[model samples]
Target: MPKDAMAQKRGGWIACPDCDTLHQCGPVKAPHDVKCANCGRTLFTRTENPLDRPLAFALAGLVLFIPANLYPIVTFSFHGVKTDNVLVTGVYRLAEGGFPGVGLLVLLASVLFPALYLMGMTYVLLCSRLRQYPGDFALTLRMTQGLNRWGMIDVYLLACLISFIKLGQLATVLPGPGLYCLGGVLVCTLLASLGFDPDLLWRRFGARSDKAGSWNLLKPKAS
Candidate 1:
């Protein structure tokens, strides 16, 4: 029997990440969400356009990423003295001001992990689009999973905006290109996260391979 037929016959199972309970499901169509039978937690949503949506947004986010981090987030001028701040300015300032721990948190949450997550997501999705899973694909996917929760770019962006408002009162504060770029990347990443469908990946990369079609199985059913 073909692996595809075998998969269809068994109707693959997905384990609830929250409760370790298993649920059997078939090839569900888009515009529907699969919820865990035990925990009622949403396992994943079937997007109308699966890899394409995340791929496009992740690419857009990547395009803006360099400028977002490299350029000045904002500029402040007081009495003919002007200074420009980039995304990492807060981290540096915090460390210099006796808040090393806070600075590290800012670095990890707002900058490092988020950048890695976006890059990994883009690469993983791109590989999926090309139907070529590299040796590091699984590793990259796992990295994205751990890094997703730490992306606090929006929080840091909000902080920058507040600083802009307050510094405007004290001096001439101007929004910089980096600020706009950061905002764009944030929106793109948010949309990418929303549209990402992990099940597609499971089907392509996690299933047992043969001459037959694929199975979208993330975890094996309990014995």
Candidate 2:
């Protein structure tokens, strides 16, 4: 039998050679593996990393989250007057500056999103670890995925750097310890998210099993 035919006979994971799209192989699988439903990539063999690594990263991210939220994100000065702004303070400042929208956006992006991502991921990790079934693991997974992209502390840090460089001549702009902490938080959380294995979650949560009708696409092939 051809490789594709063989794949159909025995269930397995396949990656498209042309575009690296992931596909679950079996009789009950989605139609037409010839073109990846996600990226239109031709089907090919591929390997997936185990879930333990991502679980570790998720735990580390939880630890870093505390400091990320506690520390000051930026500091500013003008003509001998200086002020340090934590994440919430910055949002308030933005509102005071008549930029309520910007302030709310910043708060959502920096404060709200990161916290939600961290908490959500933590819950996923813990629940998975305990082998406890959540009512809506799929929904939680989606929220975590969405929040992960918006956790833009690095971008905000770069903006801080640019602002400091521009204002240094007129006023000093020194980075506080919190800035470093926030960076660590961002890096750790990013690593955690990357390390997390969604497949593992499904397996542990009983979302994927032989009884689930042979095969169901857990995650779409990445383009």
Best TM-score among the predictions, by candidate number = 1
| Ten contiguous residues minimizing lDDT sum, candidate 1 | 1-10
Q: Please, what's the RMSD in Å of model 2?
A: 8.4
Pairs clashing within candidate 1? none
lDDT of 2 by residue, 34-91 (tens): 4577776544222123345556666676677677667765677777788887767878
- Measured with C-alpha atoms, the lDDT of residue 29 in candidate 2 is 36
- Lowest lDDT 10-residue stretch of candidate 2: 42-51
* Reference-based TM-score, model 2: 0.69
- What TM-score goes with each of the models? 0.81, 0.69
The regions of model 2 sitting more than 4 angstroms off are 1-52, 208-223
lDDT values for all models? 0.81, 0.66
Give Cα distance to truth, residue 124, candidate 1, Å.
1.0
Q: Write the per-residue lDDT of candidate 1 for residues 1-223, one digit (tens) a residue.
A: 2442343334466679899997767766677888998889998787777778888998899899899999999999999999998878888999999999999998888788878888998999898778789899988887887777889889888888898888888999999899999999999999998888666665667552222246445686898
